[model samples]
Target chain A: MSVSSQDIPTAAISRLVIYLRILEALEAAEISRTSSSDLAERAQVTAFQVRKDLAYFGRFGTRGMGYTVPLLKRELMRVLGLNRTWNVVIMGMGRLGQAVANYPGASDYQFGYVGLFDIDPELVGREIRGLKVQHADELKGFVQTRPVDLGFLAVPPEHAQAAAQTLVSAGIRGILNFAPTMIQPRLIPGSSEVESEWKAVSVENVDFLAGMKRLAFYTLNPHLRPSELKPSELSSTELEA
Target chain B: MSVSSQDIPTAAISRLVIYLRILEALEAAEISRTSSSDLAERAQVTAFQVRKDLAYFGRFGTRGMGYTVPLLKRELMRVLGLNRTWNVVIMGMGRLGQAVANYPGASDYQFGYVGLFDIDPELVGREIRGLKVQHADELKGFVQTRPVDLGFLAVPPEHAQAAAQTLVSAGIRGILNFAPTMIQPRLIPGSSEVESEWKAVSVENVDFLAGMKRLAFYTLNPHLRPSELKPSELSSTELEA
Candidate 1:
């Protein structure tokens, strides 16, 4: 069955990501099949919720038998666009940027770090994770020669907007911004217009403080916890985004 | 009116954090009051959503005058348990942990980093951001003398559980786990029992890879973007958690 993207809730996509991770874990454990109930138990959602989430994509399970873990994992990888390699450029090679460049998880999902950019002359010539830190001036030219799908913004708050503008101008398709502040792309030429080339650049924020605040609230109101969190369900907040 | 936390959706609490930030910005600009529509514009949410989320707490807006910025900000801070100081300790002194310790935003919300701990003999005696790194073994004793409300778990995945256990034994009430792997608190003695002392420790996961995966999906399916993201609306994924 054909499915329109709009018909899918963003939460389902987030859940799908979690389900995919569960399937991978199951696969590594030498398990070949999993039932909706098993997936729900592992995901910390109700069985019906798991079925509904998977149903959005199409039927994958047998009525009597559960799903084959490998088959489901592949389907999810394709659905989340993880089956292919995604080239990324990291902006601002500070401590956070350097840490992100070295984060082992990215390469596991095939997110290859193609370029690293910084304004500091001291950092410009440095090689990090085998990629040389290029000056910000080279970003526009670098993208012309190399295909970079996403930019990781880890600069200080004040420079986040300008740095994002640079990434947008460089024709990056998306950004995973770690900067604590918001970056408005309005500074980029034609960003406000529907016909603008840079208008569709999507940004996903990684705010460590937001999680800290939520932990504070949950600590103060444990009884208000949406559920008794299982390890798999502990990251429910991740799905909310 | 008295409100129960169970009635509040975690997504609404996340939004409240963002709204609080917006109110702070408004107060900084010397803007005294804001309409729901205006707050909605800044928050990239519908005006009705702003009203409904705020309604969960109590009526804060006047018919035409809207909400007083400073008053709303204080109310949100109270609702979020951010009005008081929260003593925190960094559990791992790795690169990611150091970056988080130096991050200036935590102090703005009254999250005070009172201690830093690591097992590395090389790092244990070093001082970072004026907080000396102590041996992991010192954690239980440290907390008895100085109260710590939260533990920032930045250890590698393999050691995340053990490090978290150390924090739990030290009586940390919550955890902001930055580890790439999930830490199941089941390892803690009596954690599975309702009457257990360690059963109440809350954990908030900060998975940088999760955000990258969402960005990949959004980049490939821009038409599926939940909404046209303005600067304030850009981090909708943050609220989804």
Candidate 2:
């Protein structure tokens, strides 16, 4: 059955991560259960919003007892597709790419680094963090051998699109692109003899520059408090921009 | 008096940047004006949402017509505090720090690299991207000499809090922390004091891991869809997560 109209919103996914982290912290502190109000306070949303976001996944939280810490955490992890280990690859062995590839927390969340690739001839075949840096040409071959779930693109803006195409052509889908350029996904129309494949890929862009601009705008406009951002949704007095 | 209730949302600021970039591209292509629908299409939001976001700043579009390209761009830049130059300091000269310090687009956006600092003696006194890296101890002295508008924290997670404290103690109000850990703001009291000065600061955390998590989540749960994200806002049918 198609679930197009019933899909969860991306904003809710982000809030899910926030809730997941908070729940994990509470669990670490030996807290058994938490109310929507507690999650709302840490997440800077509202108790109602928390309930609604969680409702999208399934029934959660008791009538008066709230949600069990470990149960909610497990449910979120399952909904987020974090129930299994995901093999990840990093493209472009530049400084940023290397830093992301070598991040210590990747394993803590079950995101395992399986491969590193770069187009530069010198970087090809080089070993970094115990993973070999394969040439870009071998991407498809590598993907065929290993089930790469995510391709973290850290290439320069000029080469970003091509690197993404490589990942896509190699059958990699989920992309975390840090190239500061937009990449739209669409199926390529083929000739009468060729079949056009559906371009189904999920791209999450981490725009560092935009984040910096937000901080600048908010800090410069101190009179603009965090609680008054929109007409809808619960007000938040968060310290973030 | 109080503009807290009338403050623009941080999300609006982000969309403003998106509009600015799109407008710039259109201007370069000789396009003069655009309808809110056009901006919304490119920005992955509804035309009504576009009008609402822009309305938070000021009136822009003409009656029964679209907004003038250059004028809206200038207005957005001004609203985002991009009209003036922003002095930025990069702390922790690791790979990430070096990459950010030497970023090519900083000058284009009027964000200038004024100072670089790290706790390591080896990194201290090093010149990167023409800006000298000072010891973390020299942060307060450098802030006194330079009017740094943004403190970009790229230090390790363990040292993130101390690095933030240095920036705050140096009177830097705007901070963009890339540290994966949480950095809370508060006053530090000395041994013989009842209370220390309240450290009021604006912090924007750029958690890269969360971005990656979203990418993985959407890729696996393609049925969830990107447009289905926010309950309070317009439903987007665009293909992004």
Candidate 3:
């Protein structure tokens, strides 16, 4: 039941979550077991890669029998560290932050929106989706007593770094930054900076830019068919160009 | 300068856009040429990986000279299809949609928010951030004349699928879906269906979930140590678990 650092790849871990989601759907449809190929097809990956990825953790499938839906789901939940609930704090109660707080998916993932924080005095003490908006000054005190392991940064780009610094100083470890700005902060003295990791989950902006690039590429070369473009070739060419 | 479908991995291309943003910041700081090592450091990636990724696009770097600041920036812009403006429409301009509309990063990426749409009569004829909210019935007409390639969906889960179908039917080729729901729609008869092509980019609630998972893993197993967690191992473990 104990997982070491060598246990899994981050990418594979993401896919496992996706696979679990697919399995949940299948289970709801009353399907009992599924082969790697079936899972890969539904999850938009290759069967060989799926098998290889699964093998890295431990064998979860038989040669021909595939995997039991319920057992695999339980195992995935355990491996993903999802068996326990995660306390989440939304650092900004702006429209984006409020949207995130009200996001139904948060409940599905068991991410309890423990508190909401913002600096605007007019907005302070207000309630958003039932979560009271607390002042930013209370972050450290709140973290000391309640102890949040994860924080979401939905503040504007200018405030992102400061917000992250506050969270780090407040003893929060993992941050899902949505500010669409780069945040670089020096680790506090005596803190475990080595183990700390920050993920910049740029939202619709990245996707918008990506979609624009694809459209631009397509528009410029109208004669080229979409089928002619290969993902591998794109990777190689982009690197070599 | 033509890029065929075989030229890049979609994931890598997405990362390239991210790198472009970082490079822009470096350029703004008046940094001239940047070596792969420097770029990697700034982007939180490896030097060799940066070189490898850039090499796939083309030999933009000199053997030891690194990449020229302005020239590389221009090239990245061209590669990411950011050379031209992209008109965007947001459906369901509720809290999430409004957040996206006012997101400063969207404007930086040249995504002009052309309009917002909702079925609610109260919202119709109102303007949020200068983009007038229109009836959902106007979507098809607006798309036909204005010809928007991208659309953002911020509708509730129950309405997501129908909205997506409407957008696809209206000939909007690219979609940025923010609805936290699963959407599976059968291709309309006589409509194009490209297997490798993804016209709709589903931004699931995965980012938050991923951050939570990482935090859980890091916190619950503090003794596991960072060196033990190889990217590949994490991938495999997540898959099998």
Q: Report chain B TM per candidate.
A: 0.84, 0.83, 0.77
| Chain A TM-score of candidate 1 vs. true chain A | 0.85
What's every prediction's RMSD, in angstroms? Answer: 5.1, 6.1, 8.2
**Tens-digit lDDT string for candidate 3 (B152-216):** 78788678877877776676655666776554432212234532133433222213344455555
- On residues A40-131, what C-alpha lDDT tens digit does candidate 3 reach at each position? 65666678878877776677877767788888887877776778788989898888788778765667767788989999997789988787
Task: Tell the DockQ for candidate 1.
Answer: 0.49
Question: Per-residue alpha-carbon lDDT of model 2 for B136-166, expressed as tens digits?
Answer: 8888898888688889998887788778878
- Expressed as tens digits, the lDDT of each residue in A1-241 for candidate 1 is 2457645767677788889888877787677878887787666676888889888778888776778889989888887889899999999998889878877688889999999999999899999988899999999999999788999998988888789878977888799999887554433334345226566888888988789888888888876665543444322221110
Clashing pairs in 2: A9-B228, A9-B229, A10-B229
Model 2 chain B: lowest-lDDT 10 consecutive positions: B232-241
lDDT of 1 by residue, B127-220 (tens): 9999899999999999999778899998887888788878876788799989887665533334345226556778788889888888898899
Candidate 2 residue A97 Cα shift, in angstroms, is 0.9
True contacts kept of each: 0.61, 0.54, 0.23
Query: Which pairs in model 1 have colliding backbones?
Result: A237-B241, A240-B240, A240-B241, A241-B237, A241-B240, A241-B241
Name the regions of candidate 3 deviating beyond 4 angstroms.
Answer: A28-30, A41-45, A184-241, B37-52, B184-241
Give the range of the ten consecutive residues with the poorest summed lDDT in model 1 chain B.
B232-241
